[model samples]
Target: MIALQIIARLLDYPDEALWAHRDDLLSALADSQALDEENAAKLSAFIKPFCAAELLDRQAEYCSLFDRGRATSLLLFEHVHGESRDRGQAMVDLLDQYRAAGLVLDSKELPDYLPLYLEYLASLPLEEARSGLVDIAPILALLAARIAQRDSHYAVLFELLLAISGVALNSADVAEKLQQESRDDTPQALDAVWEEEQIKFLSEQGCASAEETAHSQRFAGAVAPQYINLDAHFESGTAGESRP
Candidate 1:
C-alpha cells in the first residue's frame, strides 16, 4: 500500500517538491514490504539516477515521454474509451467513486489519471487495492511494455504495479506488440496528425474525415501547473506536468 503511494509520487511529473522529498521518497520506498528483492533492485536502479539528475533534466524527460502522443498516455480511460462519448460518463462515475471513498479532487485532474488512481488505491484496504490494480493490470502492462521499449527507468513503476496485482508481463508478447506498433510520438507522425486534421476540416464529412479524426485528442486540456504529489496533503508545491 505504501509502495502504491510511493509509485504515485514518482510517477507524477517531477518538480521541486518531488526533488525536496527525494530522500524521504527513497526512504519510504526502501521501507515498503511489498517489493521483492528483484523489484527492490530495479527500483533502486531507477530511483537513484532519477533523483541524482538535474531537476530540469527530469522535467524535460517527463514531458518528452508523456506529452508528445497518446501511446504511453497515463490517462487510463484514454486506452479504454478512445474519444467515444462513454468516456465522459465514465469519468463521472469514477469521480463519484472517489467521493464515495471520501477523497476529493480539487485539482483539474480528471478521474482515471493513473497516479491519482494509485493514490486512491493506497487509501483503500489491501485486498481492495489489489483488486483495483488487477482490474487495470492490462493497461499497466501496456504502459510497462512501451516504456521498456524506450529503455527508460519509468517502466519499473508499471512493472512493480503489475507484480503487485499478481500479473506477469510476457516479454515475447510485448516484443511482438512493439514490433507492430508505430511511433505515434515521433515528429513526423505528430506533423502528419495535424495535417490530417487540417485536411479533414477542408474536406467533406466522409470516411476519410472519420479515419483522420479517429486519433484526435479533443479532451486533453492545456498543460498547466498542478501538484499531484503529497504536497497539498503535506504542504503546497508544484509536482510534475502530465497531460491527462
Candidate 2:
C-alpha cells in the first residue's frame, strides 16, 4: 500500500501539496516490512517507465526548446497557474529523485523527437551506442540552453534518453554478464561482420570520438595554404625572442 502510494504520488506530480506529501509516502513504504522484494522490483520497474514517459510528455509540450520538431501538445504550461506547469515540474522532480537513487537516464529514444532519433540511434553499432551515452551531456547541454530560453529541447532530449534507457541498461547487463562469463558466447558470422563494419564507419567518419571528430572535417583538400614561407628557412630563427 505504501509503495502503491508512491507510484500514485509520482503520477500526480508537481502538486505543491502532493510534492510535500511524497516523503511521507516514501517513508511509509520504507518502514513497512510487509513489502516483498518481488513487489519492490515490480514497483521500481513501473515507476521507471512512468517517470520516463511523463518526462517525454513534458518535453513534447516544450518543443521549441528542441532543435527539431514542432510542438504537438497544445496543453502546455504558460508558466502560469495551471496543470501543465505542475505536471512538467513533477516529472522533472521524479527523474531527479530516481537519479539521486542511482538510476540512469535513458539514452536512446527522444520521445518528442521519437522515431527519427530512434532511427539515427539504431543505425549506430553497439560501441557507438555505448559511446553515445558519454556524448549525451553535450546534447543535454543544448537542451538545457533551449529550456533556459523557454524552448522545448529538454522535453525532446528527455524523451530520447528515456527511449534509449532500456537499450542502454540491457546492453550494460549483457556486457557485464559477458565479462563475468569471459565472453564464452560466440557471435554469428553476420553479427561479427556488422559490428566490424560499424566500428570502421564510425572510425572513418570520426564519430568514434565525438569530441575530436566534431572538430575535424573530411574536406576535399581543394584549397591550398594562402601564404608560403618564401625563404624556406628550415631552422628555428627565433629561439627565445617574442615577436609582436
Candidate 3:
C-alpha cells in the first residue's frame, strides 16, 4: 500500500516539496517488503533521473509527456473512450463509486486520472486493491508500452503496476491498440479528434462502443459485486479518501 502511495506521488507533477522528501521516500520504498529487490531497484532507477534533475526541469518534462498529448495521457478513459459521450458516462459512474465509498475528490481532477485512481486503490484492502489494479491492467499495459517506445523512465512505474496486479503485458496487442487509438496531438489532429462528426470507424463499426462496453463490464464485475459492501464503508467511516 505504501508502495502504491509512493508510485502515485511519483506520477504526480514534481515540486519543491516533493523534492525535499525525495530521499526519504526512496528509502521507504527500498525498504518496503511489498516490493521485491528488482522492483525496488526499478522504482529507484525511475526516480533517480528526475531526482538528479532540477525540479523545474522535471515539472516541464511531466507537462510535455503527459499533458501535451493524448498518446501518453495519464487520464485512463482518454485511451478507452476518447472524447466520446461514453467517456463522460464512465467518469460519472466512477465518481459515483468513489462517492459511495465516501472518497471525495476535492480537486478538479476527473475520476479516471491515474494517480487519483492509484491513491484510491492504495486505500483498499490488499485483495481489493490487487483486483482494482487488474481491472485497469489493459490501460496500464498500453501506457507502459507507449512510454517504453519513447524510452522514458516512467515506463517502469507502469510495469511495476502490472507486476503488482500479476498481469502480463502483451506488447504486440498493446502496440496494435495504440496504433488504432493514438493520434498526434497537433492542432490539426486535435481538431479532427474533437470534430463534431464521430470518426466513421469508431461510430459505425462501434469500436468505441464495444470497447467501452467491455471496459465497463470488466470494471463493474471487478468492483460492484465483490465490493458492494464498500457502501457500508461510508457509514462506518472506514473507507479511505484521497486527494490529488
Model 1, 11-117: lDDT tens digits are: 89999999988988778877887788898778777788889999999999999997777878899888777788999998999899899999979878778889999
lDDT of 2 by residue, 1-244 (tens): 2332343244232344643453455456565332456544544544444344445464444342222221122111211213345656744654564455455547452222322223333334544433433333223222223233343223333323423332222122122222222110123433443454565577887667754343233221222221222111211321232211
TM-score of each: 0.80, 0.20, 0.72
lDDT at position 163, candidate 3: 76
Per-residue accuracy of model 3 over 20-48 as CA lDDT, tens digit each: 99988877786566678888888888777
| Model 2 lowest lDDT segment of ten | 226-235
TM-score for candidate 3:
0.72
Best by lDDT: 1
Residue-pair clashes per candidate: 1, 17, 0
lDDT score, candidate 1? 0.74
Which stretches of model 2 miss by more than 4 angstroms?
Answer: 1-64, 67-115, 123-126, 133-136, 148-156, 159-244
Alpha carbon lDDT at 105, candidate 2: 48
